[model samples]
Target: MLVLAVDTATPAVTAGVVRLEGDTPKTLASRITVNARAHAEVLTPHILECLTEAGVVPADLDAVVVGCGPGPFTGLRVGMATAAAFGDALGIPVHGVCSLDAIAVEAALGRDLLVVTDARRREVYWARYSGGVRVQGPEVNKPADLEPTPSQAIAGSAGHVDLFDLPVEPVETPSPAGLVAVAAAALGSGAEPAPLVPLYLRRPDAVAIADRKK
Candidate 1:
């Protein structure tokens, strides 16, 4: 199956065209722009360029996958909205994969691995994975406050990795291929996808002016 995948849960704005057969996903083309502030500016163009490089058009995609993030509200919103627009226009199923899970999929770490990403606010969003399957957390807390676990190593945002004492993996963002790989089963089974929900573990910073005035 041909898939269009995108992620904007971190500083990297990522997009790709992928070919999935069974459980293996092969990326046909990918584009990444490492600009924390460019999610809205770069996502669509990155996606278009990826498709072009892969020699596929929007009509050729069988499904769309996006990272539903435990990330900043604005970044997650841009990615999810763009992906939904594509799925709706093409009449294809849009699958929402956990951004952390996507990072874990590519890490191939052990039962003692943890995944984390910069959640801003002097904190991080984290989850513990047992051989790539999440077993704990998508929770946010300061590095010092995170409950001590048996985590042996960590993989995620490069900026935040050094905050913890574990060995680090090179992955810094959820790649488009990793996003699709997390949804491979649903795509192959032709299951109805769940609705897109941004995993903003906390409320957004923006509030109505009336509320702010109190």
Candidate 2:
């Protein structure tokens, strides 16, 4: 099966094409850009480039996998919208995986992991993984504000762990490969992609004009 996966939940704009056979997934093409603002522009081109490089078109894909992020509202929507649009056009299945889980899956050993992404404003979007599944949360806050719990490994930006000592090595950011794995499982399970939903764990930075007037 051919799958297209994308993630724009953090500073990076990531997209990839994977060919899945039996129980494994192989990367045919992929790209990761760490610029926050380019997500809107880079996402579609990356998808097209990935498909072309893989020598497969959208119609050839069996499904689409997307990172449903607990990320900033604006940037997170770009990836989700793109994935949903492609799925709609191709009439194929699209599945959403936690972006943090995708990052955790990228680490060594596939053990229980705490994944975090910088959310700016001195906070982050975080989650915990266990046995290749999300076991704790997809929450938003400073790492120091998070519950102090033990983990087998850590993923996402290393800055997240600066406030606490952990049992495992810290991995910075979710890799394209990890995002693909999570998406693949969702597809394999016959999960349906809902309307593109931004997993914003917190409110937007902009206050409403009405509220500001108060």
Candidate 3:
């Protein structure tokens, strides 16, 4: 199966083409830009470049796997909207996986772990994982508030990972391989996809003019 995966839930605007066979996923091509403000500008070109490098066209994609973020609203909106547009235009199913879970899947070592991403306002979006499966939360809080144990290891946004004292995994963002791995089951089984929902754990930064007047 051929899958197109993209994630804009972190400072990295990532996109890739992956080929899945049996139980594993192999990335054919990928593009990543680490500018926090470039998702809208770089994402589409990244996807097209990935497909081109993979030697496949959009119609060859069997599915689209997207990182539905617990990220800042604007980034999540860009990623999810692009995934939806691709899925709609190509008539393929689009799967939404938690952006943090994608990082967890990449960092899994069959032990307790933590994944966190920048949520700005000096806060982070975090989740605890047991053997790579989400066992605790996809919650947002100030770094010190959720206190992790010394034995636990962590992965995800580099800026925020330093706040926790646990052992760290250098993986600072979601990879295309990790994104597809999170949705491997559904993609393999050909299950119907659920609604694509963005996990903006907090409200948008933008406020209505009327509400601001209050």
TM-score against native, each model: 0.97, 0.88, 0.97
lDDT of 3 by residue, 145-210 (tens): 988873379888888888888888988899999999999999989899999988887779998999
What are the runs in model 3 whose C-alpha is more than 4 Å off?
Answer: none
Residue 66 lDDT, candidate 3, scale 0-100:
95
The deviation in Å at residue 2 for candidate 2 is 0.6
lDDT tens digits by residue: candidate 2, 43-144: 999999998999988889998888888888888989989988998899998887788877776675555667778888998787777777777888878767
Off by over 4 Å in 2: 108-111, 167-170, 189-191, 207-214
How accurate locally, in lDDT, is each candidate? 0.90, 0.79, 0.90
> lDDT tens string, model 1, 1-214?
9999999888889999999989999999999998889999999999999999999889999999999988999888999999999999999999999999999888887558888899999999999988678899899999889754688888898888888888888877898779988999899999999989899999899988998899
- Of models 2 and 3, which has the larger TM-score? 3
Q: How high a TM-score does candidate 2 get?
A: 0.88
In model 1, residue pairs whose N, Cα or C atoms come closer than 3 Å (at least 3 residues apart or on different chains), thus clashing, are none
Q: Rank candidates, lDDT, best first.
A: 3, 1, 2
